[model samples]
Structures are given as structure tokens and as C-alpha cells.
Target: MKVLIITYYWPPSGGSGVQRWLKFVKYLQDFGVEPVVYTVENPKYPILDASLEKEIPKNITILKEPIWEPNNILSFFKKENTQQSAGFLNPNPTFFGKILQYIRANYFIPDARKFWIQPSVKYLKKYLSEHKIDAVITSGPPHSLHLIGLELKKALNIKWISDFRDPWTEIDYFEQLPLTKKSIRLHQQLEQEVVEKSDAVLVVGQTMKENFSKFSKNIHVITNGFDNDIDSTSITLDKKFTITHVGLMNADRNPISLWKAISDICNENADFTADYEIQFVGKIASEVRHSLEEYQIKKVLDVGYVSHQEVTKYQQKAQVLLLAVNNVKSAKGVITGKIFEYLQAKRPILAIGPTNGDLAEILKETNAGTIVNFNDVENLKKEILQLYSSFKNGNLESKSNNIEHYHRRNLTEKLAHIIKETVS
Candidate 1:
């Protein structure tokens, strides 16, 4: 079987989104499918996660098409949103940030990826004519890729699968965008259209699958999993109780109160104060900077972004890995890709997020770590002190063995099954 995957986030440009497709393509061969990837030449992605580039397979074919997004022009204007402008140079958004958001939300079709649709359709239409593909799968945040798949399904009568890394209309951060009322309705309508048209719709977590079931029966949950090769090494945990968080982080996901609590207790307790570090190693939100500033925690080490291989080393060295899920209505369905990596690390996790979602459930089942409700200062503080005491008293032990089910090859095999069933 020949499968063509359209994604906006692809390696060289890294993040959680890139890993899904990259890993899928890498493992699809085992299930008797040949994978070909279609991605944008110029992506309006937030940052370049160079670490993730190593994960891309060398043998797989990749087709890159030039994307002329209005964002290039909007970014030139240096825009700012009136409500909450970080007033910093946002990598993607410029001074015309508000204008760009307005144009993108209102003018761009289903999602901002609306810009990629025409070009993608134009390119893929021509590409498919020469290459016979068994199936086409489009994963999104750039739901525009799905729109192109929807159009292709109509034009060529080919089986198209649409994967949703996150919910479309159900995304918690939807309201944060500069979308007009009309555009919001249009976004929902377009999302439904994608749902109605696609042969199958893949969601990342169980809650996402349940949420999308109200709209389309096509939904299936094929979750994110950790790379076995990356986690195969043995790591010796350090004596100091080091809590680590990797990947892109923002204030909303950062537990400020927890940091404050840690500072307060450590100040009072010499044992707790002796050795504890909040190690953050990736793109950090300004809100996190503000919290770290407020608490004056010099131990909040910003280790910038490191390569993917280094992530394994970092996770291995830390006593407790940290998973920060945002607090949004849609957050209930969100299971971060980091959790799977954390599981593979064979270290206890200290999660700062909701206690109800799939993440909390998995953590509880896996005996991976302690989950504190988001912004629950007292509980977070208590957990920190407990961790400090455990480390100081030599009571900490690896508890990640229970989550072996989240291994990458198994997850990719699950995805392969979904694709086979969809095309059949």
C-alpha cells in the first residue's frame, strides 16, 4: 500500500505535531505500507525544533511545495492584539499580530491552513496523476490539509483519512484567536464538512475521540507514543530531586503557585532547600518567566531547546519528570505527547494539569507519578515537599514500568491497522 500524508508540521520544524507523522511513516513499512509525505516548503510554525529532525526517516520520500501564506505579509506589519499582547516578538506573529489573526480567522477557510488548501490541492492533484497512492491521510492543526484531502476525495474518488491531533472547533484555545463571530461559525461548518467527507478521522486520545463522536462516527483514537530506540538506554537517577519539563511551555501550563510553594517551603526547610531544581528545557511562555521572576527562584533553569536524543538523557537524569497540561475546557481531552516520553523515561512524573483527563487516568494506571490539579497550590506544594523528602530520605524509585503499553512501535501498528481498515 502506498500512503500519502499531508502535514504542516514536519521535521527540521519540530514539535509534537511532527512526531506523529514522522513516526507513523517510519513504522508503516512494517505493516506492509509504503509512506510518502507532503509538507509545506515555508511553514508558519512557531519555532524550529532541531532536536526532532533526527526522528525523520531517511529512506521515505518527501515532497515539499512552496506555500505563499498571507502570514508573511501580516508578520511584516508588527501587529498586536488589544486583549493580550505579550508585546514580544512572537516568532510567527508580528506587530500586525491582531490584523494577521483577523485576516487568518475570518478570511482563511476552515482553519488558518486555508492558505495551504489551494496550493496543496493544485500540487497534489498534479502529483497524484503520475503517482498512484493507495490512500491519502491528512493530519491537522492546519485543518486546511484535511480540506485539501476532502477536495481530493471528491475529485478523484480516493480514500482520504483526516487525523485530528487536537479538536477543531473544540480546541480550548479557539477563543484566544482573533476570530470573528461569523468566522467561528464558518470554522465549525468547515470542520463538520471535513468530518462528513473523510473516510476516517484519527484523534490522539480517548477523550478527543469521545468529544468528536457527537459530530462524526469516523473518529478513532490512535495515541502518541514514545520512541523505543531513544528510551532503550539505561539512566542513573541523580541523588538530587530534579523535576524536569520538556517541550513548548507557556504561562497557562506553568504552575506558578506550585513554584511559589516550593520556594517558601525550601526557604524554611534546610533539607528541602539543599538540593531541588526546576529544570525547563524548551520554548517557555512569557507567563512562566513572570512567575519565575515573581518567586525569584534562581533554580528555574532555562536550558533552552535541546536535541531529541538529549531529551532521553534529561528525562533519565531527573528524579521526577513534569507534565504540564493547560487549563481549558477542551483540556479534558488533551493528552500531551510528552507523557508518553515521560513513561518511556522510567522515572516518576510530577504532573501539573487536570486530574480528570486521559493523562491523569494513564498516570494513575501506570503508577508513573503524582498528578496535582492545575493551579492547586496546596496540593502542588504538598507534592513537591513530599518529593523533596522522598529524595532526601532515599525513598524514590522508578515507577514507569506500568506504562509500557504506550510504546511507539505498538502505537504505530495501531495506526497502521486504522489506515488499512479505512482504505478497505
Candidate 2:
């Protein structure tokens, strides 16, 4: 079977955005599916990891087209929002920034990438006439890409699949955006059209499946999986009890209560103060920085952002990995992509979110980590102290069970089955 995947993020554009499709494309050929990638030619990515280019399947066909980015042109008006990555808007912007934000919210409609939709449809329309593809998969957040899929389906009556790595209207920031009632209604309408028209709709979590089930009868929950593992032969674990968070973090995910608990730990236990260190491995919002300071947490090793190659090492070596989900209306469905990799890392995961949310369910199924609710500062402190004691005893590690199904190869096999079903 052959599938054409239309996505904005690809190799050389790093971070969690590219990892999903990149890993899928890597192993799709092994599952008897030929994957053709269509992406932007000149992408102005906020983060770049040239290392990811090596992961692309050799001899695979990759289609690229030039894109005119409105974000770049709008940068002069709203430097902060323009520079921000998708789904992560600046928590606080200047007065003028608010104006641009309003413009972005109302004018962009689906997203700033809306401009790419028509051109992509025009480009892919020509390509489809020439090449033989059994199905077309549109991966989004630049949800406007789904509009391109909608157009292709109408134009050619092709089998279409829309993959939502994250939710559309249910995304945490959507309600927080400066969108007017008309804009909100428009967003919802488009989301419904895309979900209803697609032959299959893919989401990353169960909550998302439940939320979107009313729209699409063929919704499938295919959570992100980890393909790579790090070698821990030479790298020694840090002597200090380290808690590390990897990937892009926004204000919504800032763990204020967790920081307070850590602060209390540092204050109450003198030995803990000397032995504790917190590290952030990617772009952290200013809100997170202020919270860290408010707690008087001094020991920090923030390596801003690094490549995927380096991230795996951090995941493998940290004494405990911290996963913080957004505390918003959509928090229940929000599952950070890194959790799968953290499971593969075999380090104890300390997560903060709804105790019964999808993330907690995964941790329970795997027995890889413990989760404390957002306001449970007492339990948060206890969990930290328990981890600290384990670190002292030198036996703190994750013993996950039944995780092989979440491997990239296995996930690709499942995806191939879906593709076959769609085409049939």
C-alpha cells in the first residue's frame, strides 16, 4: 500500500512536533506501506535539530514545496507570538502584542499556516494525478493541512485519513486565545467538517477519542510511541538527586504546587537541599522561571534546548523524570509526547495532572511512575521524599511491563492495518 503524508514539521525541524511522523515514516516500509512525505521547502522552525535528518528512510520519496510564512511577515508586529511554536503562545505579551494576538486569533482562523492550504492542494492535486497513492494522511496542527486533504478528497474522491496528534478545539490554548465568538464557531465548524469527511481520524489518547467520537465514526486512538533507546554504559547517573523535564514547556504546565513542595523539602531537610537539583532541557516559559525563583530553588541546570540525540541521554540518566500536563479545561485529554520515551528510559516518572486522566492510566498500566494531582502538595512532597530515599538507597528505576506494543515498529504495523482498511 502507498500513503502520502502531508505534514508541516519534518526532519531538520526538531522537537516533539517532528518526532511522531518521523518515527512512523521510518518504519512504515517494514510494514508493507510506502510512505511519501509532503512538507514545506523553506520552513522557519522555532527549533532545529539537523540530527533528525539522518532518521529519514533511505530511498524514500519526499515532496517539498515553497511556503510563504505569514508568521515571519507578522513578526514585525508581534515578535513574541511569531517566534512561538505551534500550540504554545506567549503567556503574556505587551499591549501591542495583544493587538497582534487578536489579529492572529481572528484573521488566521485555523492557523497562520492557513495560507499553505490552497497551494498544497494545488501542488498535491498535480502530484496525485501523476503518482499512484492508495490513501492520503494529513497530520496537523497547522490544522489547515486538513483543509488541503478535504480539498483533495472533493477533487479526486480519494481515501483520506486525518491524524490529530493533538486536539483541535479542545486544545488547552484555544479557549485562551483572543478568538471572538464568530472565530470560535468557525474553528469548530472546520474541525467538524474535517473529522466528519475523513475515512479515518487518528488521535493520540483515549480522552481525545471519546471527545471526538461524536464527530467521526472511524476514530482511532494511536498514542505516540518511542522508537529509540539510549546506551547507559559510559554515562554515569548524577550524584545529586536530579529531576529533569524535557521538551517545550508552557505556562499552563508550570507546576506551582510541585515547586512549593520542593521548596518545602529544601527548607525542612538540610541534607535534601545539598543533594537536590532541577534541570530543564528545552524551552521553558517565563512563568516557570518565576515560579522556580519564587520557591527560591537555586540549583538548576537549564540546557535551553538540544537535539533528540541528546534528549534520549537525559531521559535515560535522570534520577526521576518530571511530566507536567497543562492545568486547563482540556487537561484531561492532554498527554505530552515525551511520556512514551520516558517509559522507554526506565527511569521513575513523576507526573502532575489529573489523577484519573489518560496519563495516569498509562502509568498505571505500565507501572513505570507515580502521579500526584495538581493541588496535592502533601502527596507531592511525600512522593518527592520517597524518590529521594530511593535515590539514596541506589535502587530507584522504572520496571515497566507490557510496553512493547508502544514501540514505533508495532505502532507502524497498526497504522498500516488502518491504511489497508481505508483503501479497501
Candidate 3:
């Protein structure tokens, strides 16, 4: 079976968005499905990791078309050499920034990539007429890609699947966008159309599935998972009781309570403080840095934005992996792609988020780690001390269960099954 995947994020454009489809495409052939990737020829990626290019499967078709984004025009107003940061949704914007956000929200409709929809539909219509594709899949956050899929389906009557890595209107930063009442209604209208029109709707978590269920009964929860390709048997653990977080730490995800708990523990127990280190492996927001300074927690290391190849090494080495969901209204629904990787790392995880959310359920099921509520500093301190004591006794480890279900190849098989069912 041949499926054409339309996505905005792809290899060499690193971060969470690229991993799901990239890994899916990597293993699809094993399940008797061939993937043809269609992405922008030149993209204004917020973050770049050249190492990810090595993971693209060989002998697969990759089609690219030039995209012109409004960010290019907006860049003139900002400082030179200032790249756009992901997950940094500025809650409070300057006057000029607010104006830009207003224009982006209202004029751009779904997103800055809205311009790509018509062109992509037109281009893919021609390509599909000549090619022998069995079905089509479109992944989005730039939910505009779904618009392309909708048009293609309308034009060609193709079997189409709309994949939502994150919710459209329910995204964490949606409220922060300076949107008018009309724009808000338009976003909802478009979201409803995409959800109801697609042959299948794929979501990353149960919360997303629930959010879209009202629109489509053919919703599937194919959570982002880890590839079991890393050989961590020979890797050595870190000397210190290191708590490492491996992705972007925006202001919303800043673990203030955890920082206070760590500080409290350090103040009460000098020996524990001496053996503790808090390490962050990606971009850190200024607010997070300020919190660390406020806590007087000096044993810190920031290895800014390492390649995905390097992430597994850090995950394997750490005494405890830190997973902090963004403390927003949608905290209960946020399940990051890193959690499954942490499970595969086989290290005890220390997560800070809602205790009853999707992430908490996964942790409980896998026996991966303990989760404390965002405000539960006392519990956080106790958990940290217990882990520290275990570290000292050389008994700290994760007894993750049912993790085989989340392997990349296995997930691809499930995805292939869905595609087969959809096309049949």
C-alpha cells in the first residue's frame, strides 16, 4: 500500500513535531506500507537538528514545494539573528507584538502556513493524478495542512486521514493569541469541518481523542512512542543524583514548586545537596532561569538543544528523568512525546503535573515513575528524598512494564492496520 503523508515538520527540522511521522515513516515499510512524504522545500523551522536527517528512510519518495510564510515579513520588525522560539507563547506582548499577533490571528485564519493549502492541494492533485497512491494522511499543528487534505479528498475522493498532534482550538497557546470573536468562531468552524470530513482522525492522547470524538466517531489514539533502537546496556549512569529534563522549558512548564522542594531538601540535608544536580538539555525560558536563581540552586547545567542522538545518552545517564507538563488550563491533556522515550530509557521518572491526567495514567501503567501535582511541593520533596536514598544505596532503577506496546515498529503496525481498514 502506498500512502502520501502531508506534514509541516520533517527531518532536519528538529523538535517534537517531526518525530511522530518521521518514526512512523521509518517503520511503515515493515508493515507492507510505503510512505511518500510531502513537506515544504524551504521551511522556517524554529529549531534545527541536522542529525535527524540521518534517520530518513532510503529509497522513499519525498516531494517538496516552496512555501512563503508571513514570518518572513514579520522578521523585519524583530531583531536580527533572533530566531523564533517554540513553546514560548508570550502571554504579555508589546504593542508592536500585539499588533502582529492580531494580524496573525485574524488575517492568517488557521496559521501562518495557510498560504500553503491551496498551492499544496493544486500540486498534490496533479501528482496524485499521475501516481498510484492508495490513500493520503495529513498531520497538523499548522492545522492548515488538513485544509489541503480536505480539498484533495473533495477533488479526488481519496481516502484521507487527518492527524492531530495537538488540538486545534484547545491548544495551550490558543488563548494567548490576540484573536477577535470572529476569528475564534472561524477557527472552530474550520476545526469542525476537518474533524467531520476526514475518513479517520488520529490523535496523540485520549484527551485529544475525547475532544475530537464529538466531530468524528472514527478517531484513533496512536500516542507518540519510542524506537527501541538505542543500546543503553553499555552506558554508564551519572555520578550525581541528576534530574534531567530533555526538551524546551517554557515559562508554563517551569517547575517552580519542584525547585522550591529541591531547595528545601538541599537546605535541610547538606549531603544530599552535595550529590544533586539539575540538568536541562534544551532551550530554557528566562522565567525558568530566574526561578532557579531565586531558589539558590547553583548545581545546574544547561546543554542547550542537543541532537536526538544525544538525548538517549543523557536519558540513560540520569538518575532521574524530569517530565513537567505545561501548567496551563490544558495541563490534564498534555502528553509530550518525550515520556515514551523516558520509559524506554529505563530510568525512574519524576514527573510534575496533574495527578489524574493522561501522562499520570501512562506512568502508572508502565510503573515508570511517580507523579506529583503541580503544587505538591511536600510530596515532591518526599519523592526526591526517597529517590536520593535509593541512589545512595545503588538501587535506583525503573521497572517499566508493558513498554513493548509503545515501540515504534509496533505502533507502525497498528497504524498500518488502521490505514488498511480505512482504505478497504
Candidate 3 lDDT over residue span 1-424, tens digit each:
9999999999789898999999999999999999999999999888888888888999899999999899899989977965445368565678887787788778998999999998999899999999999999999988999999999999999999999998889888888777889999999999999999999999989999988889899999999999857787799999999999999999999999999999999889999989999999999888899999999989999998888889889999999999999998998899999999999999999999999999999999999999999999999999999999999999999888999899988998999999999999
Compared with the true structure, the alpha-carbon lDDT of candidate 2 equals: 0.90
Task: Output the number of the lDDT-best candidate.
Answer: 3
The 0-to-1 C-alpha lDDT of every candidate, in the order given, reads 0.78, 0.90, 0.92
lDDT string, candidate 1, 195-240, tens digits? 8788888988888777667778978888888876553356677666
Query: What number of clashing residue pairs does each candidate have, in the order they appear?
Result: 7, 0, 0
- 120 in model 3: Cα distance from truth in Å? 0.8
RMSD of 2: 1.3
Model 3, residue 143: distance off in Å is: 0.7
Q: After superposition, how far is residue 26 of candidate 3 from its true place, in Å?
A: 0.9
The estimated TM-scores of all candidates read: 0.91, 0.98, 0.98
lDDT of 2 by residue, 66-99 (tens): 8887778778765454467545677677888788
Model 2, residue 62: C-alpha shift (Å): 0.9
